[model samples]
Target: MALQIGDTAPTFSMVDSDGTLVDLSALKGTKVVLYFYPKDDTPGCTAQACNLNENLDYLSSKGYRVIGVSVDSNAAHTKFKKKYNLNFSLLADTEHELVNKYHVWVEKSMYGKTYMGTARTTFLIDENGIITDIISKVDTKNHSSQIH
Candidate 1:
């Protein structure tokens, strides 16, 4: 079942681009913006990440830490981050563990070809680890405003 707004955010341990282990449970007492995207460096994904990167201070000011998740490998995430200068952590869900745990991995369609992929979604979790909101239809360019 899809996670509901009042549901507790699933705890996960994933590796970031720098090979640092990031455990969601460790981020207690901080609001989290966990976004799942299809791929790193893609047009829409890049736009979304850049928007969040540009608004990192605003998010932090609101006591929110942003984490982007994708099935891309850490090397790909490193390249994307370096290329775009993204200022937030990008979790490498290469094994689809976190994505599946969050239920973002599902069947997707592109050009009428159905295949498994990451659905662009964002979960806003409060300090207590409760989900406050879920953005299923993300606006890539105006994402920060959407969250704020």
Candidate 2:
């Protein structure tokens, strides 16, 4: 079943670009902007990540800790983060555990070719871990406005 507002966000323990462990359960007291992207360094994904990074301080002022998730490896995330100077955690979900749990991994079509990939979705999780909103139609360049 798809997750909805009021549903408790699934807890996850994944390593970030720096190989540091990030556990969802450890973020209980702060709001979370858990965003899933298809790939690192892709145009749309890059725009979204950069926009979020640019507005990170504003979002943080509202108590939202942004965390980007993708099936990319830690090495890819590190390079991407450095290239963009991203100031947030990019969780390496190479095993697809987080995507599957969040139900963002789905069939995708491009150039008439069908494949499985991550959907660009953002979950607004409240301080207590309950999902307050889900942004399925993300505006890559202005995502921070959509969240905050």
Candidate 3:
């Protein structure tokens, strides 16, 4: 089933690029901007990540913490973060756990070829863990503005 606003966000515990454990259940009292992207360092993903990073302070001021999820390895996430000086946590969902749980993994079509990939999606979860908004068509360049 597709996740919708007011549904409880799926809980996850995964290691981030910095090797720090990020557990969703542990962040109960904090609002979260949970985003799923295709891959680390890709053009669109990079733009989205950088845009969010650049506007992180504004998002933080609104009491939201950003967390990015991808099926990339921790090493790849580390390199991507270092390359862009990203300040938010990039969770390495190498096992496809988070992607499947969040239902972002889907069949995609490009150039007449069909393949499985992570759909660019964002879930805005409130302090109590209930999803407040779902951004299916994300604007990579102005993502933060779309969040509010």
Candidate 4:
């Protein structure tokens, strides 16, 4: 089932782009923007990541810690972050645990062929760890303002 607003976000720990282990529980009491994208360095994903990066100040001003997640390796995340100067942390869900927990993994069709992939989705978790909002149909550009 898709995650819903008011549900406690599934807690998971994974390596960040910096290769440091980051636990979601450690971020308690801070509004969080946890986005799940399909991959790193792809056009749509890059645009979405950069859009958020460009509006970090506004997000922070509203008390949110923006974090992106994908089924990518830490090394891949590092390169992607550096390539785009992304200010947010990207969690590497190599095992797909978080992806499954968040229900972003699903059937996708490209060129009329079905495939398993992440559905570009974003969640707004409140300070208390409950999901405050969910944006399943994310628009890559102007995503930050769109969320707010």
Candidate 5:
């Protein structure tokens, strides 16, 4: 089922790019920007990651915690974050549990071929861990203000 606004974000514990285990339940006092992207280092993904990187200070000042989730492994995430100087955490979801729980794991078709992959979706979660907004219209070029 698609997680709607006001729904409680599924509690998950995933390894971050730095190999730290981050549990959603532990961040109850802060707003969270949980973004799910298709992959790492790709054009759109890079743009989106950069946008978040540039505005991280602003987001943090507003009491928001930004986290990116993808099917990429910890090693890949570490390389991508280091190469791009990303300041936030990229959660590794190799098992696809969180992806499926949030319903971002979707069927996509490109170049006349179809495959199952994550859609570029984002969830704006509140301090109480309830989803406040859902951004399924991710255009990488304009991702910065999409959270606002």
Candidate 6:
């Protein structure tokens, strides 16, 4: 089931692009914008990440710490970050741990072929770990406005 607003955000501890551990519990004192995307370097994913990168200062001003989760390997995330100059951490959920916890892993269809993949979803978690919002239809280019 998808997580709902007001539910306590699921806990996650994953490796970032730089190999540092990022845990939800470790971010308790700050609001979190946790986004889950299908892959790194894809067009939609790139646009979303870059859009967030562009508005990082604005998000920071609003006391939001942005994090992106994907099934991509840490190496892929590192390249994507360097290529796009992304300002936030991209968590590598290679084992689909966080993705499954957040219920973003689902069956999808494209070109008449169906397969299981990561869904584009974002969770806005409050300082107390309760989710304030969930963005299921994320507008890649104007996402920060939605968060604000």
Model 1: per-residue lDDT, tens digit, 42-95?
899999999999999999999999999999989999999999999889998888
Candidate 3 lDDT by residue in tens digits, 1-148: 9898999999988778898889999999999999999999989999999999999999999999999999999899999999999999999888899899999999999999999999999999999999999999999999999987
Residue pairs in collision within model 4: none
Candidate 6 positional error at 44, Å:
0.7
Model 4, position 116, has a per-residue lDDT of 96
lDDT by candidate, in order shown:
0.92, 0.95, 0.94, 0.91, 0.91, 0.92
Candidate 5 lDDT trough over 10 residues, lowest sum: 139-148
All candidates: TM-score: 0.97, 0.98, 0.98, 0.96, 0.96, 0.97
**Which portions of model 3 miss their true places by more than 4 Å?**
none
Report the C-alpha lDDT of model 2 over 65-108, residue by residue, as the tens digit.
99999999999999999999999999988899999999999999
Give candidate 1's error at residue 56 in angstroms. 0.3
**Model 5 lDDT tens row, 22-113:** 88999999999999999999999999999988988888888898899999998999999999999889998899998999999989999999
The Cα RMSD of model 5 versus the native structure comes to: 0.9
Model 5 ranges with Cα > 4 A deviation: none
Instruction: State which candidate has the highest lDDT.
Output: 2
Residue-level lDDT tens digits of model 4 in 76-114: 999999999998889988898989999999999999999
lDDT of 6 by residue, 17-74 (tens): 9877889999999999999999999999999999999999999999999999999998
Evaluate model 4: give its TM-score: 0.96
Question: Where does model 2 exceed 4 Å of error?
Answer: none
Q: Which stretches of candidate 6 lie over 4 Å from their true place?
A: none
> Against the true structure, candidate 4 has what lDDT?
0.91
How displaced is residue 24 in candidate 5, in Å? 0.6
